[model samples]
Target: MLHDAMWDDEFPHDPTICYLNHAAVAPWPKRAADAVSAFARENIHQGARDYPRWIQLEHRLRGQLQSLLNAPGKGDIALVKNTSEALSLVAMGLDWTEGDEVLISDQEFPSNRIPWQALEGRGVTVRQVNLDASDPEAALIAAMGPATRLLSISSVQYASGLRMDLERLGRACRERNILFCVDAIQSLGALPFDVQAIDCDFAMADGHKWLLGPEGLGVFYCRREARDRLKLTQFGWHMVEAMGDYDREDWTPASTARRFEPGSPNTLAQHALSASLELLLEVGIQRIQEALQQRTAYLLQSISSIPGARILSPSAPERRAGIVTFTISGCPNAWLFQQLKDGGIVCAERGGGIRWSPHFYTSQQVLDNALAILRNALQHYNRSR
Candidate 1:
């Protein structure tokens, strides 16, 4: 396992800021920035002269993503503009009957919820299941009726950090012949995700959050057997089998997940993402998960020790990921958020509370500094009250 010191050079964040916002936009590592810089310089010196090498990097990125998700093959992966685009492809591509139902959690990010809800125009009903029950997975499975065609859910709840029992849900979906789609934006780089182990038909995640890459590129994994189920919703030269044969009058979409990419590739973003994935792969996902859990555990324990802190996120080690959200009694969330922002403690205001998300590389000093700021702010608020 790599220690914090070993990875210090990779992340040289501003010393003054306590960055706990990996759940939102993450700061790219030094290697990723260097990759982008080098690419930019090459483009300036020789435009398209080294385009073949850039394509090779793109291929390598697909292989890295294949390893990250543990998909059956590299061909199962599609590099989309972002998670929303990928979800849109799945949502718009699938044929929906009048009575078909799509099951999802009530706590999903808008990206996960809106796509299925959009299908309502096609006579498809979107059912949102509350995940506050003792057995969230069981509740979701029970809600599935004969009309249920798909179960679209996030691997981890964005606001509450409630990690789902994907294996259990996937098994139930398989038994019921229901399609399973995972919006993994919050959990992909923070945790170890396996599409094969979960048996999900489709999964998507953006690179900006935990992947430590640029904003425009994300990944979509479509199971080989389930690929043909979704009718093609977009088309262009890049998505065709004979992509380089522009002169060919006849063409067919690529049999692989590449069929979803309708336009030209984002090669610049691809270079940066490929470099970021290299760092994650080098450290190993299992190690990253361990480090991230340690950080969350510390935050949970420390926040609970505060006089009025009420943690909104799950307390159980197995039921959480990198997010820790909480609210202080008698303190307005907006006020508290502003205080943290002023104190250089980077976080997000979410789920009616303040959310602090720390990555594996987040140092003890940053955590302590953020906590100190919170304590001082609470004391000041108490005095004013």
Candidate 2:
């Protein structure tokens, strides 16, 4: 039997603020905070005596990340600074030729778009597929041509809350033989992800968002076969197999995904991230899946009952994850966002609307309170006209 995973017993704090923006930076679970605090205290007390233990913690983190992405091996995982660095590793590592093309969605976050756009200097072309179309998959598949070297996409769109059929896209890429890369920052910890299922060559996510950890650390997964295929654009002593041997005269990039990590690991962020993943693992991804589905459904139901509010996130359960977006008919999105912000209901403005992303730990009462605030905010907007 799956463990009884609903562990929300209330975080030890004021407990009044409603954080509905896991899509953005998430509030760390208390366990993760306590872990970081303990590690900090240890640093001040023991110095580097147990520093080897921290390295072991980092190795354990790689194992958990390997499980998270469902990669074939922990050898496929690289500890990069953040999503941008991982994206950059792929961007600069590619062997691009003049007229070679890369495909991405129109709704891509800048991290996913700008790196590919930088390839213009190599005479490569970047194509943005419109995911807002009636048939997004067809539109993306049709965008590829003989010159298409890669198809990069976000597993779940950052804004608009559009979750793509990654399996279909992966199969299409497999048939066409185009390298598939996924910017999984939005989906990795929020839902189940599998590189084998998606047939992706690479996938990456930072720890700050749904992983519920600190910034400055992230995971990058490169398939074992693709490890050497990517050109290494960055190089340093730490990425070598003889990482600690400063006297080595000859060296080579690590055959494993460590080739991408060109420096010392972020031990600080790793402890916090490992702590966060422990909670998610303890609760089980299956349970989080059901909880998020229930929360999103409840949010949609609450918003639809309001007369002038328009839900921009998908109403279909499978098409949604933790994010719910909506707009007030005549209200400026900025105004609604500010009102919600001032009201202490935390979310964001995305897809030209207000987006609310609640985690599984979020209570029904908190959401109901947020919904009440939304209704009041919208009612004021409705009246000001």
Candidate 3:
């Protein structure tokens, strides 16, 4: 089926919009959309009479997430509301001392920073390390002190699109006995990720962005050995060992990472995300990475030729991922963003410039059209000024 002539059927984006913002929310694939519709129809008419089937679907999704992260097993994966919730579980779950410190990069999205920052009242200091150096991992390592209890970093900086060397940082944390956590929302579906290879204690990603799924559902992976280290902050029937035994007087959290989930599952989102993940798995992450690399390279080359355009993202291929950010010298970022929006070029204003994030299936025609729009916008800006 993947070898079909019109494989792009999976992503039937509207012709009017040249979408280059996969780093932000993404349009769901046709299969995912179909899955959601079917699930809704089933709910409306059947009222979950086939509820056992839904559970099976959820089980499959856990397995898919497990395979995507190269996690030890499905037992290590938890379905969460979003990346923020997963980070919160880690932030509030850990038993922090008054002087304990959490290290993170200064460029992190608020999802990675705010939760740690919230611990300030508890005398937990959130240290933000500068990642602008030639060796960001080394800078993070140098910032670690005796009080540093955990290092939570993004696999890719949301705005700058700077890809971090998780293996290096993970090794450093291992040697220092610091817990390593990764906010992997940007890299999970765009690049190949291995929980084992990175050796992170916790990792989480939302399904809406690179995963090409709906919002409100995300995956959280916890290393099995570290699961018991963090205290459970929430409790519900679903999180208990005997989940269906509601009348039981004695209960304990499940031994698996599912202990983090404290309420009913998002079964509707499960149908959508499962289909999207299956599509990704069928295509394979390596192919997706290669296609995105080509798109990034093409955008970089084309943008460099435009007068006054300065690429803010890293020039080295290995240092970047799906995102390519740049600025036109004379044009205000807001003005340029408006111009692109008016021209039906769907990009974003980020990292002090305009950011373009194309996915694996983004066509060459869309890139050509968006670049043309950018050139026209720059020309108009220069002329008016």
Candidate 4:
């Protein structure tokens, strides 16, 4: 059980600002900031003197990402610049024929939807399924046709905070011989995610969101058996099987998912992201998930008691992640969002509502303060309207 006392030193957020926007770019942990500072100092004084050690840090990051995703091995993990790049690798690498279809939810962020849509130039069709049904997974599975080659969906809906049944979707895709891909940016750090249990062929997520890392680093997981399914779209010395063998005339792409990475490593970002993952690992994702659930439940209950408040996120606990979205009558989403911002409640206007995403370390006082702000703002706007 994590108490607020445990997080006193980790997140020293501004006293005037109640930051609840972890679903967006997150503030780095103090340890991550410290690591970045040390790396900057080392680079300033003795550049490349510890290059070998930096390589070790990259290896450590790979192992950490592999463990977090419950991947079969470290080789299955590739460090990509962001989730968009990883999704493009899959969308472009796969061989598609005319009329071959790809299935995705209508609620996906542009990162998940646009990649497959780009395939339309190759004669592949992108099918968007509505996930507003009681059984969203069943709706997706039922939408698959004979020509449906892949099914890609977000692990959690970004705007609505709807957590999908990845395991069931993966199983359905496997039985149908269709590849399943998950954009896990929203759930990777907020909850416990198991690629093996879900049996997904591919998963990608940026570290900046719930992982509390920098913006440029992300992890891409490709199952061992599925590694060869996507052909190489990029090539460079770093991705060669014999990475440093400059004298070799013949070369092969790496057997591992490293084949997706085709350039120099982001060493600077590695130091920061590794430290963030270390903090998450030390705290344990299961406990973090529990704390996040508690926060969401509290927010939902409080918002429900507020007159004319409409909760846009799922009402059932099992269907939610760390996001709680709501709209107050008489206050347009845009107007209410600005009012909350004015009150120092950090959140976003998404899906026609104000979305509040609180992490595990968020204090109950912060939640109450944010609610009070929202309540007052709603009343003011209601009177004006």
Residues 34-131, model 1: lDDT tens digits: 99899899889998897889888889999999999999899999999999988988999898899999999999999998998899999999999999
Clashes (backbone N, CA, C under 3 Å), per candidate, total: 0, 0, 0, 0
Tell me how far the alpha carbon of residue 77 in candidate 2 is from the true structure, in angstroms, after superposition: 0.2
How high is each candidate's TM-score?
Answer: 0.99, 0.97, 0.98, 0.98
**Candidate 3 segments exceeding 4 Å error:** 1-5
**Candidate models: Cα lDDT each:** 0.93, 0.87, 0.92, 0.92
Q: What TM-score does model 3 achieve against the real structure?
A: 0.98
**lDDT string, candidate 2, 1-385, tens digits:** 1113245542432445778989989988888888889989998998879978988897899999999999998889999998988988888987778999999999999999999999998999999988877779899999989999999999888887788889999999999999999999988888988999999999999999989999999999998877887899888986888778899899998888888888777887888899999988887777787888888888898898888778888888778888899997878999999988888898999989999998878877788889888878878877887
The count of backbone overlaps in candidate 1 is 0
Which candidate gets the maximum TM-score versus the true structure? 1
Number of the top candidate by lDDT? 1
TM-score for model 2?
0.97
- What tens digits encode model 3's per-residue C-alpha lDDT throughout 1-385? 0122254889876878999999999989999999999999988999979988998998999999999999999999999999999999999988989999999999999999999999999999999999889999899999999999999999999888999999999999999999999999999999999999999999999999999999999999999999998899888988999988988999989989889989999999999999999999998999888888888989999999988889988878788899999998877899889999999988889989999999988988889899888888887877887
